[model samples]
Target: MRDYLFPTEIERLIAAAKKSPRHGVRNNLMILLAYRHGLRISELVDLRLSDIDLQSGRINCRRLKGSTHNIHPLEGDELRLIKRWLRVNSNPHSEFIFVSERGTPITRQSAWRIFKDAGEKAGLEVNVRPHMLKHSCGYYLADKGCDTRLIQEYLGHKNIQNTVRYTQTNAKRFEGLWR
Candidate 1:
């Protein structure tokens, strides 16, 4: 099976969102967080305001497939962007972070639309799906010399086999081998 990875498209999506009247900071933040934290579509839509700790810059992402949870921290520009996004979009009493204009948590279809529209605007030829963000995160970490065990933990994958693909795809790991 092919892994739909797009670390670069993720950046392009953020850039394109800034130019869009509709995409706004919230949409950009959602896309960034999806890649940074390896979140599934359901996890992204299911986030609640209370699950975030602004002072600590931590997000308690719900690992949907395994019925577990993992804590991921925001760093650098992501932390700043999260603060800005919350300032504009958060309803203090709302049950979820990302919501429709009706103030309800966005459905899976809406999440799908968010990525698809942004990908198109970014000039990406591939059909964008939210899961690609997760794959990008995994591949990114692997390519950056992060351990497979850590990637598995960060992604909340219960099986190591699921995480092994990233190790296989990291070409840099083979660099300097003939030296």
Candidate 2:
């Protein structure tokens, strides 16, 4: 069984998250940010409002597992989604970027459930977990022929070996071997 999702599957997951009857905006943003920034579930749940700089269209990703933290550019869709989420958030005064309906900070388990449910709703055959988003990000970049060093930096991998897995499995690496 493949551990990571493809870009199309990621899109399907995001679309499913957006259709949640409750916490739709927050859930959608969670999946989107996690995939875009390659955030671990812990990092994603720990995010606070202060980490975001909407004016500059950037986000300060505080990574986990001794990974290097970095600032990532926010895409136009991400910017718009953040704005919409902020405007409609249930607890306007909450410090956390993502909160439960009752205004408490979201727990890791809940975050897991969000992805699990979204995956089921999306009709994906494989069981999906939150970390798949991170894996998907790595694989997606590798497939796109992004430099390994750049991917490592973006994903906050301190060791090149960790980043190499993504490149090693890349089908593009053998593109012209038989030609």
Candidate 3:
């Protein structure tokens, strides 16, 4: 599948989301979580109240792709966003990390729609999906010089080869050097 929003596009989407009255907070938080955590929509939707440990900056992801559980570290902007989201939305009775206005856990389809709508509102011309955010996380991490083995594990890819695809250096970056 085509990779989702580019870095610039993601920024624009977040900016647009910040202006939305109804979903501004939730949408922006979702964007931050997706890009920073490399989480699939299913994984994101499945997040429960107990999965996050803000004090420790860790997130526990359960039943990831192949019915496996993993614990991932959160840092930088991702951790901050999660903390903010929790402060704004958390309730004693709710178990899901993200909830709809009706107080139901966010569905995967809803998550996809939120990202797509946010991208359109931002005037982004590319297709945006929740998985694209996951791809962006992997791509950005690889670009920042993260080791492939680590990136592979973080993304929960069972095969190293699939993770390698995320690390494909942008050919355009080297085009100038060839001249």
Candidate 4:
């Protein structure tokens, strides 16, 4: 909703990805996934190697907070980046989708730190976190005319009201037109 990162913030992340050190590639991929899929930080951390399907351009999300397991589609650059990251970093021993330098699953704290560091390096004015990326995903989808019911399904929102809140109405567009 309004809590989501501004468009400029997304731009900053993209710039950061371009300049990030090689080791930070996984973090960048996580950022993309969070924003693209509207996933909670907990869900992101719980992801496993078996969740993603590059060939089919879909992600299988398990044990979401408010809903059952679901399949989400990937599009465009998000799909491409994920494939690239997987190709470079996939490891048999790692059960997690994202791993740290130690080859262990990245913790929630580490995920937060990665986002914070990336935002700083990208010169973003606002602090971006994993949740904010999820919010951004919802906002963007709503802005693009996605239905609230569909958004609810995609975001795993148990209540339609929660999904409604994510649809940001454009004040400027309605200004002086509505009585």
Best by lDDT: 2
Please list the C-alpha lDDT of all candidates, in the order they appear: 0.82, 0.94, 0.79, 0.76
- The 10 consecutive residues of candidate 3 with the worst lDDT sum are 169-178
Best by TM-score: 2
Backbone clashes in model 1: 0
Off by over 4 Å in 1: 176-179
Point out the higher-scoring one by lDDT: 3 or 4. Answer: 3
**Lowest lDDT 10-residue stretch of candidate 1:** 1-10
Model 1 residue 67 CA deviation (Å) reads 6.1
Clashing pairs in 3: none
Per-model RMSD to reference: 2.0, 1.4, 3.3, 3.0
Worst lDDT run of 10 residues, candidate 2, spans 169-178
Model 3, 34-137: lDDT tens digits are 77778888888888869888888888866465733678888767777766777777353689988987778889899899888888899987878788888888
Q: For each candidate, how many residue pairs have backbone atoms clashing (under 3 Å)?
A: 0, 0, 0, 0
Please provide TM-scores, in order, for all candidate models, with all chains considered together: 0.91, 0.96, 0.85, 0.85
Q: Cα deviation of 17 in candidate 4 (Å)?
A: 3.5
| Candidate 4: clashing pairs of residues | none
Task: Write model 2 residue lDDT over 1-179, tens digit each, in one string.
Answer: 88899888999999999999878899999999999999999999999999999999999999989999999999999999999999999888999999888999999999999999999999998899999999999999999999999999999999999999999988897799999
